[model samples]
Target: MDKLKGKGKEAVGKLTGDRRKESEGKADQAKATAKDKVDEVGDRAKGVTDSLRNDDK
Candidate 1:
């Protein structure tokens, strides 16, 4: 969602030649990427925990 919005903003910024908007859009994309990576790591950890618990049962 945010990544898509950021991309739109970036495209608009490029079209309008707005440097500030472009920078902001880039920042938003970076934030979204970091968040996605964190979520992926957390999901992997949860999967591992679930597998271990199931093994004990």
Candidate 2:
């Protein structure tokens, strides 16, 4: 969702030739990407825990 919003902002900035808005949009995208990576790592950790628990049972 945030990623989509950031892409929209980037598109608008390019259309309007606003350097500041473009920079802001890029920053937003980077933040969103970082959050996604964190979530992916957390999910992988949870999967490993679930697998270990099942093995013990």
Candidate 3:
């Protein structure tokens, strides 16, 4: 997602000669960061569930 946004921003900046690429890059990075956080949370939840199941033995 961040890469996509950066590419898009670069393309648009090239087309329009605007200096908004920095902001776009930041937005892309934010999206990537959020996605990583969500993935981490999911992994933690899965780990907890697996541990609980194992303890049921």
Q: Of the candidates shown, which would achieve the greatest TM-score relative to the real structure? A: 1
- List lDDT for all candidates, in order: 0.92, 0.91, 0.81
Candidates 1 and 2 compared: the better one by TM-score is 1
Q: Which sections of candidate 3 miss by over 4 Å? A: 1-17
lDDT for 11 in candidate 3 is 75
Q: Which consecutive 10 residues in model 1 have the weakest lDDT in total?
A: 19-28
Could you tell me the lDDT of residue 28 within candidate 3? 80
lDDT of 1 by residue, 1-57 (tens): 889888888888999999888888888999999999999999999999999999999
Q: Lowest-lDDT window of 10 residues in candidate 2?
A: 19-28
Q: Which pairs of residues have clashing backbones in candidate 1? A: none
Order of candidate numbers by TM-score, starting with the best: 1, 2, 3
Instruction: Return the lDDT, model 1, position 26.
Output: 87
Number of clashes recorded per candidate: 0, 0, 0
lDDT of 2 by residue, 1-57 (tens): 888888888888999999888878888899999999999999999999999999999
Worst 10 residues of 3 by lDDT: 18-27
TM-score of 2: 0.89
Which residue runs does candidate 1 get wrong by more than 4 Å? none
Residue-by-residue lDDT tens digits, candidate 3, 1-50: 67677778867876787768756765787788889999999999999999
